[model samples]
Structure formats: C-alpha cells, structure tokens
Target: MNEYKDASKESFNDDFCSYLEHHLTRAFANAEDELVQKVWCDGVLMPFFENQTSKKSVNDTKRIVTKAWIGQDGQGEYELVIKFEKYSLRKYARGSSLQDCVPSERTLDWINIDLARRTIEIQLT
Candidate 1:
C-alpha cells in the first residue's frame, strides 16, 4: 500500500512551522529567486504528476516565498505547505537581485512536504 494512504492526520505546531520556514530559507540563501521557486515547485509537484490519478496543469511562472505552515491533507499526515505566488516584472522594481520581480498579493500555488516520509505532494486545481 502507498504510505500516503496510510499516513495519519495530524497538525504540526507553530514551532515546527517556524523551523521549516527557516530551514528552507537558509538552504536557498545563496540561490537566485527563480531557482528557489523552481526547486520547491519541482520537488513537490513531481510526485503528484507521477501518480496515475493526477492530471493537472502547472503554471511555471509562480514563485515560492520560502514561507511554510502546517496544512491538512485530508487522509494523510499534515504537511508543510510552502507558499508560491505569482510575480510580475516591473521596470521600476528595485531589489538586490537584478532579476527581481514583484510578488502578487495572493498565493498562486503550494508545495506540501510530508515530514515522516520525506515526500512532497500537492493538490492541483
């Protein structure tokens, strides 16, 4: 049986969420913003696409914000859903990175990490 199907439904506390957010931030501290966004989405969504039941189309333009929080997965263990939002380039956008893009107000995607299995999953719309 798939481990995800047998996993328990539990919520991670605020401390754990904070730890995860910090961890991801540190891991990608030297990387470019676009690279960080790509890594998170690819890491989490690859498994979703490999499953026979999934048939969702992903928008690659979304960017990850390195912010994570506990989120329920219905049947499986609670996951850390990393925030991925839309970003658009503006000529006047100022930042340390030359390729900086302005982030949208709302999240456009999520990448869920299951700590027990060290796996990532997401529900695509």
Candidate 2:
C-alpha cells in the first residue's frame, strides 16, 4: 500500500510538471513584450490560486485587482496583491447548486518575474 501511494504521488507530480511546462510554453510563445508577459502572468493570480486554496470553485469570483510591481533596488523581484470580496457558501448556493460557497478570504501572492532571462518564479509563503 505504501509503495502504491508513493507511486501515485510521483505520478501526480510528473503530470503536474508536464502540465505546467506545456502551459507556460504556450503562454510564452509570443511573449516578446515584457508588459505583455507581465500582464498575462500578473493579470491572473494563478500561483496563489494554485497553491493557497484547495477549493477549485473559488476562481469563479476571484479576480486580479492590481498589477505587478518591483522594488526600487532592481533585484529582479516582483510582487502583486489581489483583492476579492468574501462570500458565504450558503449564500452562493442559494442561487446556484454549488456547495460550500463562501466569501473568498483576502489573499496576497508574490511573484518574481525575471524579464532578462525570461523566467517567472513564484514565492510561496
């Protein structure tokens, strides 16, 4: 059983890596413009949503409220804060069939965009 669990976990990681590689490759295909890449990456808080929350339905109401910013020291580091209103699961279910609907908790995710090397790194805290 343990061996099977380990294998399953490894498979999930492998699949996730493959998915990320494919997605990022497609996203960066025409990413010649720095602002375009920044906008595309920063426009949606994918990292935060992917890492912080276990609920998949949160994406329905979540949106990026701000743009990415870098510190004054030019450290190749960038940060963006996203804000969304909180809702209750019961309230959401009132009009929809979704269960466990609730106001999303305010969350902030920081991302580092390296324009020189054309790489994006997410910091999980």
Candidate 3:
C-alpha cells in the first residue's frame, strides 16, 4: 500500500483529475514487469443517480488521488485500490449563466483495479 499525499496541486480545472489518472495508470503499469508489455487496461464510471431526483444522474467533475495500493486477494487475483478526493467545479459563475464557477473540494471516491482482468471500476458517489 502507498499513500500519495498532495499527488497534485489543487486546480479549478480538470487538470488535477487528469494528473490522478496518469499517475494511477503508471502505477498499474509498474505492478508487474512480465505483464507490462502485454497488458491492456480500460475503465468505466458507472452513472450516478441523484438522491433528490432519482430520474436525474450526476456526473463526475474533478478528482485527486490520496492513496493507492496493489495486493493479491485470496483467489490470487491482483487488485489495485485507489482512494481519490473528489471536487465539483462550478460550471457557471455564481449568480451568472456563464460557465465559470470556482472548484470546490469534496469527499473521497474509490477506484478498484483488476490487474488480471485489465479493468478499472469506480466506486464513486
């Protein structure tokens, strides 16, 4: 297990999210040298439903990594777990129609990596 404190500087844009993804990908790549050249990875963010309106769904805005770890389960499957700090970037300026809202940091979100399956799964809010 590894902790990545301040993995990146806080930003109003999605740059922080991109940085987290890049670092996570690198960690995945470094897990196993034998599978490095042969592995292919992909991921999906399951749609999130709003609590107030079940018919409406929420989208992810920004993310930052706080911790990560690679381990083998009882089944001998390698798994990578990443804990990320989430944020909501105000798309519109306060009291304005323009998309210029400041970014606000939120709580943590989790991402699970299956090295053997070459897939990533998000346990997001």
Candidate 4:
C-alpha cells in the first residue's frame, strides 16, 4: 500500500476530504497497473449490526473511499474496468484501532461501461 504522507505538497487541496477525493480520482484516472482487491458484501457489515445495542441500522457516513482502480485479474480483451471502494471501519475486529480501519480485502462484481457502444453490462454474481 502506498502512503499518502509523502506525496507532492502542491497536489493536495486545502480541504483534506477534497485532497483525498482529488488524489483518488487522479489515481484512478491515471493508473498504469492492475489491482484486484478482496471483496466484501452486506454480510461483512452484519457483525456491526448484530453487536449494536440499539435496534437501528448503520446510518453513519464515516466511509473512506480512497481505493479505486482497474483490475488486472483477467485483463486481456477487457475494456474500461474500474472499481470504487469504500472503507468500512466497523468491519474491524472488536478493540481494533485506527490501523484496522484500512482496507485489507476486496471482491469482484464485473461492470462494464463502454463509451463507444454506450452500453452498460452488469454481472452481479
């Protein structure tokens, strides 16, 4: 994983969120490598709900969407592959701290956005 503590000073915006957003967008837009992350689903978030004392769903907006990329698992003959990841702090183990907040797994659900064909193919399996 790349560290954000030592990137170009000018490339960062005044707002930290904007800085992360801009960097994430640029990172996705100019990627020259293949990235296949471990996937997660609603099941991954289940423990949070199960352990909550209150009878409510997780309505908080404390997500970190810094990892976006084009995967390379089966790159040949594929086009316009991308991934937008959202970090889940609640997915960490009990008593885990900030270090556990980082993404360590990902899954694939293929989605194709063909600009020339102007068609979208989604495979939710």
User: Across residues 17-125, which tens digit of lDDT does each residue of candidate 3 receive?
Assistant: 3444444444444544444323323322112222311111122333322222333321222333222222222321111121112211121123345556644444422
Q: Highest lDDT: give the candidate number.
A: 2
Over 7-60, each residue of candidate 4 has an lDDT whose tens digit, in order, gives: 212211134223322333333344333331211111011112222311122113
Q: RMSD for all candidates, in order, please.
A: 16.3, 12.4, 14.1, 14.8
lDDT of 1 at 98: 12
lDDT of 1 by residue, 65-110 (tens): 2223322322332332322223321111111121222122133233
Model 1's TM-score against the true structure:
0.22
lDDT of 3 at 125: 27
Candidate 2 structure lDDT: 0.33
* Model 2 segments more than 4 A misplaced: 1-12, 30-112, 117-119, 122-125
User: What TM-scores do the predictions have?
Assistant: 0.22, 0.28, 0.28, 0.18
Stretches of model 4 off by over 4 angstroms after superposition? 1-14, 33-125
Off by over 4 Å in 3: 1-13, 36-112, 115-125
Residue 32 in model 4: lDDT: 34
